[model samples]
Target: MPRITYIEHDGTEHTVEVGNGLSVMEGARDNDIPGIEADCGGACACATCHVYVDPSWIGKIPAKDDAEADMLDFAAAPTSGASRLACQIRVGDHLDGLIVRMPETQG
Candidate 1:
């Protein structure tokens, strides 16, 4: 399992051990971490699971695909270089201690 940390806009943080191969969005929802709406149920059809990848971990995660990039246009908050859909990030050993910052809102 990989340990992931999700930080809210107000500075609240939730840390949990996520099972390998599970999406980050699923990890958050399963652990009751607030902020990740995942309205599309990890299908990558919505931006509700948007998050900002920690700078240090930016190079670790895979680049966003065209579909995810398109969905980000609908995010409630402004998207930046760090913006990523949690549902697109799969948990793995290399992602241990990964930290993602949640925006103020998710459309």
Candidate 2:
């Protein structure tokens, strides 16, 4: 398991141990965390699971694919180079200390 920290727009934080191989969106969804909406249920068809990767960990995570990048355009919140769809990121030992922040809203 890897411990991932999800920070809400209002600054609330939830750190939990996520099972290896699960998507980051699953980590938040399974834990009842308030921020990630996951409307498409990890299909990568919706940007509701959007989150901004913490600055330090930005380059460490895998790069986004075309589908993820395309859907992010529909996110209700603004995005930056750090913007990513949680469903596209899988949890693994390499991401044990990963941190992601939720935007103010989701699409």
Candidate 3:
């Protein structure tokens, strides 16, 4: 399992160990973290599972695909280079210390 840290917009932090093969959103959802809404489950159909990858992790995670990039346009906050949909990022040993920060809202 890989341990991931999820930070809320208000500065709350939750760290949990997530098994490999699950998406980052699933990690958050399963841990009962408050930030990521994951409206579309693990599908890339919605942007509700949006989060900003930590700057140190921007180059570590795989780049977001076209569909994920497009869906992010619907995220509540403005998207930047670090913006990513949690559903699109899979958990793995390489991401043991992955960190993500949720935006203020997810509509």
Candidate 4:
């Protein structure tokens, strides 16, 4: 399992161990971490699970696909170079200490 840390807009942090093959959104939702609405349930159809990968981790994960990029346009908060949809990030050994910050709102 990989350990992931989720930080909220107010600086609240929730760290949890996520099983391999699971999406970051599932890890957050399963652990009851706030700010990751995951309204589309990891289907990549919505931006409710949007997050900002830690600057140091920006290159650790794969680039977002076209569908994810398009859906991000609907995110309530502005997207940045580090912005990513949690559902698109699969957990793996390399992401053991992955850290993502939640926006002020997910809409």
Candidate 5:
């Protein structure tokens, strides 16, 4: 299992345990976390599950492919680095303490 921490725009944080092999968006949604909308249900088509992965963990996370990269453009208040669509990040046993910062808006 992997434990993930989600930081909201207000600086509040929520941490939840997630199963390995599941997507970050699914982890948040399963835990009932408020920020991750996951409107497209892990399809790369929507950016509603956008999250800012901690800089220190950027190297630990996998790089996005062309499809996910294209979808990132739709995320509101986009960031060039550290921003990723949670649906594209799969939870793994090694990511026991992953942390993600949520942005204020998402389409």
Candidate 6:
């Protein structure tokens, strides 16, 4: 299992253990993490699952694809090098301790 660290806007943190093959968005939604809206249900059609990849973990994650890259353009918090859609990150043994900070808003 992979444990993900979710940090809310006010600095509240929740760690959830997720199994392999489940996406980060799924992990958040299943555990009821406050900030992950996941409105499009991991479809990549909505940026509701938007998150900021903690800089320290940036290099460890894979690069985004074209579709995910385009969806991020509409994210409310402004896209930067760390911006990513949670639906794209899958839980894996190597992803243990993955840390992601939620945005102030989804839309």
44-101: candidate 6 lDDT, tens digit per residue? 9999999999999989999999999999999987567899999999889989999999
Model 5: lDDT to the true structure? 0.90
Task: Please give the lDDT score at residue 41 for candidate 5.
Answer: 92
Residues 1-107, candidate 4: write the lDDT tens digits.
Answer: 89999999999999899999999999999999999999889999989999999999998899988999999998887567888999999999999999999999998
Each prediction's number of clashing residue pairs: 0, 0, 0, 0, 0, 0
Residue-wise lDDT of candidate 1 within 2-79, one digit each (tens)?
999999999999989999999999999999999999988999988999999999999999998999889889887755
Q: Candidate 1 clash total?
A: 0
Q: Model 1 residue 102 lDDT?
A: 96
Better of 4 and 6 by lDDT: 4
Quick one: RMSD of model 4? 0.7
Candidate 2's TM-score: 0.97
Tens digits of per-residue lDDT, candidate 2, 10-107, equal 99999999999999999999999998999889999889999999999989999998999999999877567899999999999999999999999886
Q: Ten residues in a row with the worst lDDT in model 6? A: 73-82
Model 5 over residues 1-107: C-alpha lDDT tens digits?
A: 78999998888889999998999999989989888898889988899999999988989998889998899988988788799999999999878899999999776
7-105, model 3: which lDDT tens digit per residue?
Answer: 999999999999999999999999999988888897899888999999999999999889998998898875688899999999999999999999998
Candidate 2 global CA lDDT score: 0.93
Q: Which ten residues in a row have the lowest lDDT in candidate 2?
A: 72-81
Considering only N, C-alpha and C atoms within 3 Å, which residue pairs clash in candidate 3? none
Give the lowest summed-lDDT range of ten residues in model 4.
Answer: 74-83
- Model 2 stretches with alpha carbons more than 4 Å out: none
**Higher-ranked by lDDT: 1 or 4:** 4
TM-scores for the candidates: 0.96, 0.97, 0.97, 0.97, 0.96, 0.97
